[model samples]
Each structure stands twice: as C-alpha cells, then as structure tokens.
Target: MAHESTDTASENGPELQRALSNRHIQLLAIGGAIGTGLFMGSGKTISVAGPSVILVYMVIGFMLYFVMRAMGELLLSRSSYRNFSDFAGDILGPWAAFFTGWTYWFCWIVTGVADVIVIASVYVTFWLPLIPTWIPALVVIAALIALNLPSVRGFGETEFWFALIKIAAIVLLIVIGLVMVFTGFEHDGARASFLNLFNVGGGFFGGGLMGFIMGFQIAVFAFVGIELVGTAAAETKNPEHNLPRAVNAIPVRVLLFYVGSLAVLMSVVPWDRFDADNSPFVMLFSLAGLGAAAHIVNMVVLTSAMSSANSGIYSTSRMVFGLSTDGNAPKAFSKLTRRQVPRNALFLSGVVLLSAIVLLVFGLGESKGFTIVTTISSLCFIFVWSIILISYIVYRRRRPQAHDESIFKVPGGTFMPWVVLAFFVFLLWAFTQDPDTLMGMYATPIWFALVGLGYLLLRKNPKHQQLRRDHEERIAQEKREAAAYLAAAGSRKVR
Candidate 1:
C-alpha cells in the first residue's frame, strides 16, 4: 500500500548502468533466443513433425523476426525507455504497460519454473540418482538468485558462457553429422545419409497435417526467449547499434541452430528413431562412438536450463521494477541493490519459484506437467508479442513523425504489423489443432481477466492516479520544450 519513498535518486536519475558490451549483448541475445527447447525439446519436434519440423522452425523464425524488429524500433524511439513497458506506457497507455509488463513477467516466471524443474530432474537422475529432485530444484533456484544478485555484468557473463556451450554443441553436431552423412557412416546398421530423413517410415511430411501442426506447438517454445533482446536495450551501451544487430541476427541463428542442426541430426539419426523424450544430439553423439556423450550432453542441457532460469530472474525482476515504477505493482519491487540489480524483485521472484519445486514434488514436471506449463507459457508469450505489434501500429498511426526519426527503423513499417498479426492468428488457429495447445489457448483469457482486474484495482489507488497524472504532464512538458527549441533553432538558421 505504501508507494512513496525518501529515496528518489532512481526516480530522478538513470537507475540501471549500461554495463553490458557488444559481446555480452550478442551472446545474451543468442542465449535468450536459444533455450533447452532446442537441445531437449527438438527430439519430440523431429519425431512428431518428421522432416517438416524444418519448415516449422523456419516459419516461427520468420514471423517472430518481425516482432523483434518492431520491438527494436520501438525501444530506439525514446532514449529514456528502459524496456518495452516504458514505450508501451507512453504510446499505448498505462494499461498497456500494466498488462504487457506483468504478462512478460509471468512469461519468464513460467519459463523459469519449467527450466529449474527440468534441471532438478537432470541433477537427480544423472548425478545424485538417489536424492529427491525437489532438493536440486531448490538449490538451482537459490543459486540463480545468488548469481544474479551481484551485478548485471555477472548475468551477462553467465549467459555468455552458457550461450557459448550451446553454440559449441550445435557446431559439433553439424560438423559430425555432415561428416557421417557424406561418408555414409553406419550406426546400429542404419546408414547415416541424407536419405535417412525421408527414407524412413514416412516421407518428408511423414507426420502429415497433424504432425506438422504439432511441430508448431513444440517449436514455438524454442523461441520463447527471443524477445529478451528488448529488455536489454537499456543496459547495452550504444543500443542503437547493439539492439538491432541482435534482433537482425535471429533469423540466421535460427537457420543454423534450429534448421541446420535438425537437418543434420535427422540425417545422422533417422527421424523415426528419434525419441520424443530424449535429446537427439546425445543420441547422435552416442552413435558416433562417444561413450561420454550422455554425460556431456547432460551437462549442456543442465547449463542450457540454468541459463534460462538465470534469465528468468533477470527479466522478471526488471519487469517487476517497471511495473512498480509505473505504480502497477508494489513499491518494494522497485528497490535496487547497491549493485543496481533489482534485489527485492529478484528475491520475490525466486521465492515464488518454489512453486515449481512443489509441482515437481506432487508428480508433475519433467515431461508430464512440463508440457502443460510450457504450453501455457508459450500462450502468454504470444499475447505479449501481439501487444508489441499492436503498440507498433499505434505508434505509427499516432506518431508517424517519431517513426520517421527512428534510426533503426523496422522495414515495411506500416504493413508489417498486420502481417505479423495475421501470422500470429494463424499460429493461434494452429494451437487449436492439438488438445494441449487448445487448452493453453482457452486458459489465456482467465489470466488476462485477472490482470485486468488487478489493473482496475491499482488504478483506483490515489497514489496510482497521481502518478499517472504526473507522468502524462511530464510527457506534455517535454514535448513543448522540444517544439520550442526546434522553432528557435529554425528561426536562427533563417536569420
């Protein structure tokens, strides 16, 4: 209930330092774009969609690219904007910020839950074998919070190494898979050839319509963290250059990491042979006569999940800070530690993550409840993406001059949002094709309704109203000063 603070330093200053560099931004972008979804989830994608999973990854990448561009342009439009929530609030409304900010927070929280729980299982099964999974899950959650509590650079460095491992794994897979394919290497009496892709069981579209549709459900999860680049805009020095570079490289990365890896993987190990429950990378390594493949792949998967959970803590804490700054959340969330990280928000986020461990304790998680939770998380992300596109459209309509002035412009400005939106609609329809995804879509409304109710409640608070009024007034004042300065400069030039 208490909103005001004697500590107004952050309110009047640039609270977060720009400690992330080009390399940090690049690797973080890669880490955010790639997840355990590629390493651990692709087997199911290959098994269910057959070779058509290639197209599924391509399509998802294509659509999400526009979303990232729109986000990049939006973030670049204003210097003071910390994340999408700031621009959303200024252009769309406080309500947009309230919803999008919280929804994004919800997104990473859900994702982190799924990641930590899986990491816990991996620990218990592979290393501890005799210990309870919940213990490991708790340990992971605590460790992420500790790692993140230090500084933003720590988070960046952590992701740098994590992303490096993923890149190494993919490169290794592609190199080895290509060699086997070209040499016609035989594994378990099955020749590793390009023909292995379509020659086994069913051809290219082996799974047919339903199979391809199912790919979207799993493949979408691979892209859940891609937009995390937007959240980094404020922390990256020279965001104009760094941010666009990160967003633009996504398609190429998708091609290499998703399409390339999967193509080579199925070539090495036939799609039919890929276990939906296991990592194809490990399988190929084992077949390549590497006895330590399982252990190595297990380490990669654990690191991949740890990277995701770490990102969740970083993202959710920032989002909560945004919400709190906008008077949409508790003021405690805005408290920044000496290190400039949102310590209180991070603490609260980790505290809530215990629910993930709880879910695992009750016979959920790993593959069973994980599928459902991730589906719902995917649904939340789709909503957040839609809001960004919609916000971009509004920005163009209401402030075309701002778009004209933007340095890193989103190509096909006016028409692209519609294209992205339509693609999203198609994806939603695709979700309807499967029971699990359909349930996720159905559950979305309830989440939004709850958020809307919270918005209404927050709007009623006197302090919230005052903050909104002051925020609008501040914008108006800045606009007037800019216009007057431009007019005086023009007159002086004419004289």
Candidate 2:
C-alpha cells in the first residue's frame, strides 16, 4: 500500500518516476565502482605505496563489498522505502535522517568538486595547457547541469553511455597492458613482468608500513561512488531483482577494474615510475610511444571525470529532495519539475560546485587541490557509509522478522558490520598520518558541529515536531503489519 502511494503521482505534487531500467542500474553500479579517483588519484596512491597499492585497493574493495551487501538487504526489506535515507530516518530516528541525508548530500558535493578539479586540471589541461583552468571547470559544471535537467531517464541514458566508455577504456588498458607484459615490453630497462610489481622500487611495501597505511587515504576515495546504486534504489525498475544483481557483481567489478587494472599498470610501468599528478592510464600509452592512444585515453579519463561529476549532481539533488520532503531541508527543494526532476535541488548542488572554480582561481594546483578535496570527500563518505552499516544493525535488531524474510541477507551474518566499522576506524587513523589528509580530517568535524546546531534549531519548529510524530507512528504501524503478516504466513505453512 505504501509503495502504491509513492508510485501514484499526487495532484498536489509530482513524485519521482521509476524510469531507470535494469541496464541503467547495472551500468550505473559498474560506473560507480570505476570512478574518477581511479583515473586520476591512482597515480598518487601508487607513488605513495608502490606495488603495495594493489593490495590496498583489494582490502578497501573487500570491506566495501560487505557494506554494499548490507545496503542491498536493507533496501530490499521494505518496498515502500525510497532509499537508505528513508530507512535511516525510519529506524535510527529523525536526527539520523537529517544528519545522514545532509552529510551524504555534502559528500557528493565535495566529490563533485574533486571531479571537476580533475576534469579541468588533469585531463582537460593535458591538451589545452594554455587555457585557464577555471574556464574548463565552469564549462564542465554547466554541461553536467544541463544533462541532468531534462528528465531522470536522460540522466540514466547519459550515465549508461558514460559508464560504457569507462568500461571500454579500462578493458582496453588491461588488454594492452597484458600484451606488453607478455611480450616483455621494456620501459627504461625495467622489463614488463609480474615480478616488476615487487622487483622495482620499495618492493611491495615501497613506502613502508606508514606508506601502506597512507595508501588507504586516496584508495578509499576511489570507492566513494560505489554506493550510488543504493541511492538510485527508488528509480530502479524491479529493484528486488536488479538491485541484487548489480550489488552481487561488485566483487567481480572491483577485482577486474581496480585490482586487475592496477596490477597490470604497475607491471607495465612500475609504481615508482608514475607521476603523482599525471593519470597512469594516460602515462602508460604515452610512455609506450602511442601518442594517439595516450590522447584517446586522456579523453576517456575526461569523460570518466564527467561521469563522476554527473553522479554527484544527480545523487545530491535526489538526497536534498528526499530531505526536504521529510521536513529535514527547506521545502523548496522538495518541489519537482514537470519532468520529475528536482530543479531547485539540482541547482543547489551546481551552485556549491562553483567552489571548484574558486579553488582553481586561488591557484590550488592539481596535486594539492585534489589531495585536499578528496581527503575531505573520503571522510564524509565514510560517515555516510558508517551510517548505512549502523542502520542495518539497528534494522536487524528492531525488525528481526524483516531480516528473516529478507531474500538478500548480508553475508557474514551479524558480525561483518562491526568488522567493517573497525576497518573504517583504521582508515581514519590512516588519514592522520599524512599532513594533507590530516588537514581535511581536522576540518571535517566542523561540518558535524554545524549540522548539530542546525538539528537543535530544527527540533523547536512546531511543524517539524508534528511531522516527526506522524513519521514515528507510521513506522510503528508498518512494523506491526509486517509482524502480523509473517506470523500468518508461518502458521499457514505449518498447517
């Protein structure tokens, strides 16, 4: 009945349409896993940890795969739940709804800023060295905003092609890299071989224990958008079927895309050879004397950055719209256009994106600006992800029947969430080891303090209090109905 209410557009307001198909969901998930971070940030990570960065990626991917599993199970548990934020509000409380929704919104904005920086500084400037960086930054922001304004399906189709391009590029890199390795391609007298992963540089832990720990700082950012599929839950068609299919493929995607590609990259060029500011994908072709291929890869990386910025704009708007509808944000954001696009919320994110141009104008060079922005983005996303895991734990506790009936239960049973949380704490400590990331870690709490003050003020509003009361009652009623239905079903089976 609740699902019915959401799908039926009201005369008073337009509801979000379930326009994203199975293919859209699948590609979007794949696109989320292969982010701009890999294209641009891997060079920094490789430089810091050498060949050990490959292991670093695998570990981060391993932990995040469980996080995705928790998210999948939570989304499938209730058909009426719009996204993780909806369940967070219902199960954790109103404070969580406000915090997680807004934090996740900020998460993408920060990530979009990083993506725009990479687009302008790393990829675009690679070709147009004489142009002002802000020119391209502004152009990218405008193009993405226009791409998202028409309809949800337009965004989906755009992402689908963008994701396809990224896949093709990575596949091409992996293929070329393998051919070079097998053919004994030599770069500066270092032969292309699997042994190159360890034989050169620091030999695995090239940067030492601290370097290995530091690898996670940038590596985690690479996985930031992996959960975009969870945000797209409401728009996905046949979510129960498609969501699991997409999520279940995460491990394979991580291995092939992140681990497989990086392993080959280091073998072909060795981790020490990568320049921190340059994209290794571009570097690989350039070093191999394939200038045309290098240019092509640069274009692919450019689109990869655009794809990430595109996801940031789309996810941020949907989140603000959800927050506004639930009385967590300004009501204007709740308003959707005739095409079911949240124009107000969309522009809000686009406006915040201008901060990218400011950073550029101030002369924050590619390497420094990206490090700072990505560090902040990684911390915020960890909070968003931690909220999802916590929400899942609470879901299992408060609604045992729902867990029992869940067709897609999270693996490792109830124990894995705590394990993943501990790993996040390790990552937090990793941030402190680097001065750049530590600066971001220091600034992150200011955001929470500000949001905390906002929450206090929000609670005093009489209208908000009434909305909270209504939401609490609805959640209680839904639980009762779910328990009763499960009981009846169990009795019928026994009889």
Candidate 3:
C-alpha cells in the first residue's frame, strides 16, 4: 500500500522501486554481512583469539540474530517507514531519525573509505602488482558508481554475483576441509583432525583473558553489516515476506561460513601456526595442496573486498537519499534520476568515498589505516544496532496490539533485548582492553560531537522544520489508513 502511494509519482519524486527480488535481498544481506572481516581479517582474528574466536563468532551471531528479527518485525509492521531511521523517527522522534540516518550514512562512508584503501593496497600484491595502487582504487569507485547509477536492479545484480562468488568459495573450502578431515590429511606435519581444536593448544580457551577480550573486539566487526537488510527493505519486493527469510539465514551463515570454516582451519593447521599477516583461507587452501593457492585466495579476497566497497556505496547512497528526504541532508540528494536512482546522493557518497585515495597517497599503509577506520566504523555500527534494539523495545511498549498481531515476531520478545544489551556492554568493555581499540573508543566521541553540533545548527533552520513536519504528517496519515483497514476488516467479520 505504501509502495502504491509512492509509485504514483507525486511532486516529491518517485519512490525507491521494489526492484530487489527475494534472491537479491537474501544475497545482499549475506554479501553485506560477510566481507573482508571474514575473508582477510579473519586471519588476524584467529591469530588473536585462537580457538576461542569460534565461540566469539557464535555468541555474536546468536545475539545479532535477534537484533535482525526485531528489525524484520519493525519493517513489516509499517510499510510507510522507509528504513530503521524513519521508524525510529516515527516511534522515537524526529531526533532519532536524524541521528540514526546520518550516523548510518557516516558509518558506511568511513567503511567505504577504508574499503577503497584496502582495494588499492591489496591490488599491489595481486592482479595489478605493476600498476599504481590508486589506479585500481579509482577504477573500482568509478565502476561501482556506474553499476549503481542505472537502477536498483542493476546494483542488485552486481551484488548478487559478488555474493555468489563468496558463497561458492566458502562452500568449496568447507567441502575440501571435510575431505581432508575424513582422509586424515596431513600438511606440513600438522594433522587434520577435529581434536586439534583442544589437543594442540592450551585447550579451547587457548587465548587467555586478554586474548578472549580482544576476540570480542575483533569479532564484533565481522558482524557490522548484519543489519544491512533493514536498509534495503524499501526497495525489496514483498519485504514483509522476503526480509524475514534474509534475516533468518544469518545464523546459518555464521555457523557454516564462520564457525564451520574456523573449525576446519584450526583442525587442519594448528591455530598457533596461523600468521596474523596471512589469510586463513589461503593457508587452508595451500595446505590442501592447490598449486595456485596464493593466486586463488588473493583473487577471492580481492573480489570480496571490492564487493564490500560496492555495498558501502550502495548503502551510503540510499541512506543519504533517506536522510535528504527526511530533510536532514541536502534536498538535491533526494532527487531521483529517470531510472529512479538517486544520482545526486550517489555522487555525494562517491565524492566522499574518494577520500580513501588520500589514505593510499599518504601511505598510513593499509594495515594501520584500515584498523583505525574500521575501529571507528565498528563503534558507529554498534551505536546504530543499539538504536534498532532500543526502537524495538519502544515499539513493543507503545504498540502492543501491533506486536501481538504480527505474523513475523521476534521469538524471544521482551527478554532478549536486555540480554543483547548486556552483550553490548561487555563488548564496550572489551574495546577498552586493547590500546588500538581503546584509541577508537576515544575517537568515537569526536564524531558524536560533530553530529550534535550539526543537529543544533539545523534545529533552527526552516527547511529542517518543514521536513520534520512532513515526516510527522506521513506517519499520521499511515495511522489513519491502518485504522481504516482494520475497521473494514472488523465490518467484514461482523457480516
């Protein structure tokens, strides 16, 4: 019904089309959630957490599954709400929308920036070792902008293929790992068996308190884009039906790709043998005796990192488009192209994304620069996910009837939010443990301060006031329509 209204083409401009199909939505969620964190960064994660990282992945996965469920329910409850920020604004206030929308935008902007740097730096080692690193970075930015500019479906297609490749790689690794395990494969004197998990090390908690704490610090980031599906709900076909499926698959993904892969890696190669500098994926493949193992792994991670940057551009553009429509950003950003794409928003994001090239030029080196950017980015994502959880709590309290009647409800209900909230607190404490992560914690306040300053300045602007009023009016109108629909249903039942 909301799509029916926006698709009619009013003065405000055409709505974001429902171009993402079920498969597209599912893979987009998978693609967004699984990135360099698992592919490239997992090597470091395993080096830091050892076998305990497996539990870290599982625990984070368990908590965030409910977070996704809560998000899935909220998006389905109101079609008029374009994203979590919109519903957050509607349910919490305009201020919540302003904060969440812009924070979400900034979150991806930082991530996109970091991703491009990674793209360029990784290029030097692999495909274009002879080419200038910045060249590939520029080419990737330009190419993704082209893919995104055409239509939502075009972006979906690109992401679909990207996700497919990652999935195929993961599945292949798992299958090979299984073969090695069954045949008692030995590589470089390390025997392939499940017992290697505890036998070869100081046991499953191989990493002591410090290692365990850092595990949360590192592993939390891998789950950063887990909620990306919520952002795409507006452009998804039958979101009410498709979104839940996407969200539900997160646990399975975590278990198979993360927990399963790590389980096999540690089993095949001793966790202590895992180098912080190398990919566990590459090492595993090389151990399994792929002659071109280095090249294959390099290409897989290259494509994976590129896919992540592409997702950042796509998500950031949409978020800016949402923010603009909400009157929190420039009106130009809300303007759509003939294909219903947000050309202005896409450009704004791309220009900002180009800043990543500066990191390449300045040469903080990808290792150090990526850590700094991703740390801040991860903290920002924690803030965003917390808002979604808080919004869910508010939704349950204010709209009990709506929650009661929903076809797709979060299974744990009121209790899980508290449990997840505690997990977040522990995670924040975990961030305090390492100097690098602690530095990120300290850096986070500057962003909030800047946003607060912006909010204060925008508060007095007539344009912002008008946007606020428009958003409230839209929410009010949806309430009226929902009431009428229910009334008609009641009448039909009486007859």
Candidate 4:
C-alpha cells in the first residue's frame, strides 16, 4: 500500500506525526473554499450578468464538481498518493510533478499576497487610519507566520473558527434576505414577488453577451480554492471516507452559499444597485435600517481575508514539502519541526507573502496589489487545472484497468476535460477584452516562461540528476526483489 515515507534520521520531532482529525479536515475544506473573493467580488459578478450571475456560478460549480470528483477518484486509488502532486508524478511524469508542485506553491503565495493586501486595507480602515498600508501588511504576515510555526492543528483550528465566522455571517444574511423577500419589510411596501428575478433587468443577461461571458472571470475566482480539500488528504483521520464526503458536498455548498445568496440579493435589491465598491451584504443591512451594517460586514470581510491567508500558508508549505521530497526544491524545505509541520517551508511561504507588503509600500497601492496578486493567482489556478487534466489523460491511458475500477469518475470524462480546457481558454480571452485585466493576462505567459526556465536549470543540477537516478534504481530494485521472493515461495510450495 502507498503511504507517506518519513525521513526518521533527518528529523526527530513531535511535528512529524499526523495529528489532524476528521473535524479538522471537514472545516479546513470549508475554510479553504470560502475566501474573500466570494465575499467581496460577488457583487461585481452580479453587476456583470445581473440575475443570470446565479447561473454563471451554478455552471462553474457544476464543472468544478467534476474536477473534484476526478481528484477524489485518483487519490482513493492508492494509499501512496500523498497529494495531487504525487498523483501527477505517478500518472504523468517527473516533470509534471515538478511543475504541478511549484505552480501550486506559487499560486498560494500569490493568493496569500492578495489576502495580505486586502487585510492591510481593512486594518487601515479601522486602527491605522493614517499609517501607510504596507506596515499593516507586514504585521499581518508576521503574525500569520507565527501562528503557522506552532503546529498544523493550530493553523487548522484558527482556520476552522475563521471559516465558521464567515459561514455564520452568510447564514444570517441569507436568513435576513429571505425574511425581507417574504415579509417585504425593506421593499418600500412593494409586494415581494418572484418576478424580481426578471423585473429589474434589461433582460436576464443584464450586461448582454459581453457581461455574461465576463461573469466567468468573477465566477472562477469563487472556486479558486476548491482543490484545497485534496491537500488535506495527508492529514485527515480517515481520508477515504472524509474526502469523498467533502468532495461530493462541494457542489451543494457552493450552490447554497453562492447561487442561493445571490438570488436573495437580487430579490431584495435591484441587481443594478449591487455596487462593486461595497459588499452586497452591507447594502442589504443598510437598506434594512441597520446603522452598524457596514462595520459588521467589514468584520466578516476581515475574517474572509484571514481565512484565505491562513489557507495559503498551509497549502503552500505542503506544496514546498512535496517539491523537496521530489528533489525539485531545496532539501531543507522537507525538514519538519516538532509538530510534524514543515517549518522551513512555512517560513519560506511567509517570506514570500512579504512581497505583498512591499508592493503596498513601494510599488502599487493596496488596490493595485490586490489586482495584480489575484490575476496572477487566477492564472496559476488555470495552470494547475490543466496539469490535472493532462495527468488524468495519461493515467487513463497508462492504467486502463485502474481507470475502469474508479467508483467516482469524472462525468463525460474525456469530452468534459476538453470542454473545460476550452472554457479556460475563453476565460483567458475575456481577460484580454477588459483594460483592467489585460496586463495581468499578458503577464501570465511570462510567469510560465520563467517557471519553464527554472525547470531547465533544476534539470541540469548534478544533485537533482543523482537523486532522480537513485529514485529510479530504488524502484527497479524493489520490483526485482518482489519478483524473486514470489518465485522462491512458488518453488518451495512445488517441493
């Protein structure tokens, strides 16, 4: 059976043990998927497609459901599949593993930077009204690094409560919005009608074809961390059971939290008034005559940003650790502290997050930082998704029997992968259509080119080459030994 192999002599620490429980896995999955992007960006999506934004979210959710299912089937096939990167290596090639691991690491780093920028802005709005935004950004980075250095469960617990707050806030907003829809308390005495879905629109596709298409840009952001559940497989108490449940529930949770909430927002307020500058949740409460609504929403958004940053720290560390194990990163990264956490990797990720603070301080403003980081992260997500599809294609071709045995398969398997690939291409095209996103879209290819160059350099490293040969020799020797053992046993039985 495939299982994680520990370097016993390399690190003798309390942290090297798996300590996370099923509850931690469940909540971490929730926290990972629910980020500030959904909380703050949903209004912009609504502005784009008006009421049809709901459909955009639902469609994206449906497609991502299949993606998660694919991941689940792959992970469950072998106890040795530590994470997606391992699966990528097994199914695709060593190079695929190197690319997937590093790409994912970079993705989290970029997303963490975005979260830092946003979190700094939120803090600036309250305590440090006159302080330069970068100060708070640096402080937030330092604090998160401190938190993560302790233990994995510490990170998990923090994220659990952070996610719980956001979940509770959304539940409250949904309940209140429903009441407003039914009771007509804040509707200016107009009867609540289901017709609101179509009544306030310039038709359902509110911004026309352009708007409908543009909705994917925002819709995809909400699904950015959906794959995070797969990362927790290594730490989960019972991955075979917990993973399936978490994977299956992604679609339903996304529908309830995204589509359901948007439906209420449109019913209570005209979709046109769903401002991009402020949260729709605050708008709902403000319209309902609550004076403290803005502050309340700000608190929720704060937690959302923290949640994203927290997840970034956790996922990036694991990615780096995976890379280290594969000889694609510095060996020191795989070193764990007493808590079984990759302390070196965690510190490195935190250090990278400081770039966000620097961007806020010396380069762009906070808003610009958010834009740049988010765009880069989104592009990285596309890269990761593409790797998964490529890996799955290879897995199916190489192990036809194993592929046939998967209980949970990606629906429409071969065709759907192509369709999703095309959809991502369209999203890239749409990114270029807008002036704001065009530069970021162009920057993405440059980023990949840099990664490719790095891979070439790593490939040439003597140490890495030796490690690769060693790993191959080890596998071949193991196979030969197994065959010999079986032959000897058969001869004895014949005698």
Query: Best by lDDT, which number?
Result: 2
- Per-residue lDDT tens digits for candidate 3, residues 340-435, read 899999998899888877767777645654676788998899888889899999778756567767878999888998899889999989888877
TM-score of 3: 0.92
Better of 1 and 3 by TM-score: 3
Q: Runs in model 4 with CA error above 4 Å?
A: 1-16, 186-192, 367-369, 462-495
Per-residue lDDT tens digits for candidate 1, residues 1-495, read 111222122457428779899999999889888888898889999889999999999999988998999998888876777888877777666788889999999889988888887787764579788888898888888888888889999889999999999899999989989998998998777898888777887888998888998788788988888888788776788887898888889899989998899999988877888898888988989888899998889998888889889888998988888777667788888877787888888898999899988888987775555666788898899988999899898767655556657777788877978988898787788888877777777877887899999999988899768767866775575467556766776898999
TM-scores for all candidates: the values are 0.91, 0.91, 0.92, 0.89
Candidate with best TM-score:
3
**CA-lDDT, candidates in order:** 0.83, 0.86, 0.82, 0.76
Ranking by lDDT: 2, 1, 3, 4
Please give the distance, in angstroms, between residue 403's alpha carbon in candidate 4 and its true position after superposition: 2.4
For 441-474, candidate 2 gives per-residue lDDT tens digits of 8888998999999999998999668757866786
Off by over 4 Å in 3: 1-13, 463-495
Which regions of candidate 2 fall more than 4 Å away from where they truly are?
1-13, 365-369, 467-495
Candidate 1 has a TM-score of 0.91
lDDT of model 3 at position 130: 76
